[model samples]
Target: MTGKERLIELLKLLYAVTDEDHQLSTAEIVTHFAGQGVPTDRSTVKADIDVLNNCGIEILATKGTQIRYYFSDRQFELAELKLLVDAVESSKFITAKKSDVLVKKLMTLAGENSAKELERHLYTAGRIKPENESIFYAVDIIHRAINSERQIAFVYFEYATTKSFVPKHDGEPYIFSPYAMLYNEDKYYVLGYSEQHEKIVTFRVDRMKAPDILDKCIVPRPENFDPVNYTVNIFSMYDGEPYNVTLLCKNELMNYVIDRFGDDVRTEITDEEHFTATVEVSVSQTFFAWVFQFAGGIQITGPAIVKEQFRKMLEEAHN
Candidate 1:
């Protein structure tokens, strides 16, 4: 074999068989290289390692009665890679087949041993995943439009009685100036300015298809627009104007409040047993349903108009 071939084989050996928790001694490396038809002595193996280190491979070595070497740094640590793998496996935006492919790629960032650990911990049973394969393409095109400052056009779809998606608005082409992408409720959405309505709106990216970047430039994002506040108010991606709502809640449900509204909610002790919190939320039927399901544990106590609206919604539902 050529000199370059032997050196390449040695480098592959170090990367494949060594990790932070697992190290290969000089003797073991020589044995493995020999088995691979690249026979080398201890001195030659040491020289090869030095050459690799000089070339910036970042191989770490330990010396004592026994000498061992390991690849200390990787693109991502084992723990970080494992976390990414878990996200891919658990995400609902990615399809089942795509999740497997993504998790497999994430595992390769670490060594073979670390990959086995990630594989063993993977649990992807009975989890719902999106059926739209073109969603990825839609995301790519949206990103390109955002970068190029151009408009995009696509046909939106909705679920039908036959358990399949049917195009909305009689298969009309919707045009938008995409401002940003958001992940909420484990789904992806694109916040954009709708040209047809001449207002800021959001569309489910996974439900969008045949996205094409138009020649016209995009409309600038509103100067007063706040993406963080927008995401916070868009509960369950329901469309409604935002309201600074106050809710009187039982103190025991503090965890529930934090889980839903996060830690930024303004809270005041109403009594020893209850508290009041003022939160900005998108007032919609979905938000109303969420509050109704909580029963008397939570009650809207302020904004006389909102209170009346909630009452009317309940009364209509009853009749």
Candidate 2:
């Protein structure tokens, strides 16, 4: 075979067979090539390996007698590959089918023998994967729309009682100007201005079906909009009027406060046992439910309207 063709096949063979733990002798490399009807010898094989190394493939040889060759410095280390596999397996938005496909592709980047090592650790098709296959493609379309400053249209869906997806508002597509994609609570959401709502809103990217970028342009995003603050303010991406609600929190729960509202949250140490923090949050049942879960360690201390809303919710629950 031609020299170019031989190197092409050699590279594939090396990637498939040799890693740090597995090595092929020059004779073995020639034998495999001969089996495929290519002519080569030890001298020629050594020269080809030199050329591969010059071309930036990290092929290394043994030092003493009984020399064998292996590939080193792979694009991804085994541990790094494992970490990526873990992310793919754990992501709820990726469907089990697509997750399986993606993990296998990642395995190919690891050499054949090392790929088996990765296979021992993970699989994508398990534990709370989305049923919507279109989610995978929708994220890409939304990104393109954001990059081009364009609008997009898609049918948003909610899970039915039977766990199947049902489109909202009789399957009418929601036209939107996507400004940012946000990740919260292990889910991805697009934050944008909605034509129908006439306000900024968020939609779960995974629940979007058949998303398409329109020739229409997006509305200019609010000049002062701070996406980080927006994500911090909205509890679970639920909608509500914003309120600078103050909370009396136990001093021990400082980490929890920072985790929810970030370290920059305004706070004053009220005494040895309590600190009062004023944080902007979207006031809704979800937000109150979050406070309720802390079991009185966190409580609304100000903004009488929000306090009354919390009281009404508790009273209604009591009734």
lDDT of 2 by residue, 162-279 (tens): 9987999789999999999998877789999999899899998877888899999999989998877788777442789888889999999999889878879899999999999998
lDDT scores in order: 0.84, 0.87
Work out candidate 2's RMSD over C-alphas: 2.7
Number of backbone-clashing residue pairs for each candidate, in the order shown: 0, 0
Residue 86 miss distance in model 2 (angstroms): 1.2
Off by over 4 Å in 1: 121-126, 235-237
What TM-score, over all chains together, does every model reach? 0.92, 0.89
Model 2 residue 264 lDDT score = 93
Model 2 lDDT, full chain set: 0.87
Q: Candidate 1 lDDT, tens digit per residue, 1-319?
A: 6767777887887788788678999999888878878768889888888888899888998887889999875889878887888888788778878888888887777888778878844666766877767887788889999889999999999999999989997899999999888888777898889988888889988888899999999898889988777887663427886788999999999888888888888999999999999988888888788788788899999788889989999999999
Candidate 2 stretches greater than 4 Å from native = 120-126, 159-166, 235-237, 263-272
Q: lDDT (0-100) at residue 52 of candidate 2?
A: 95
Q: Pick the candidate with the highest TM-score.
A: 1
Best by lDDT: 2
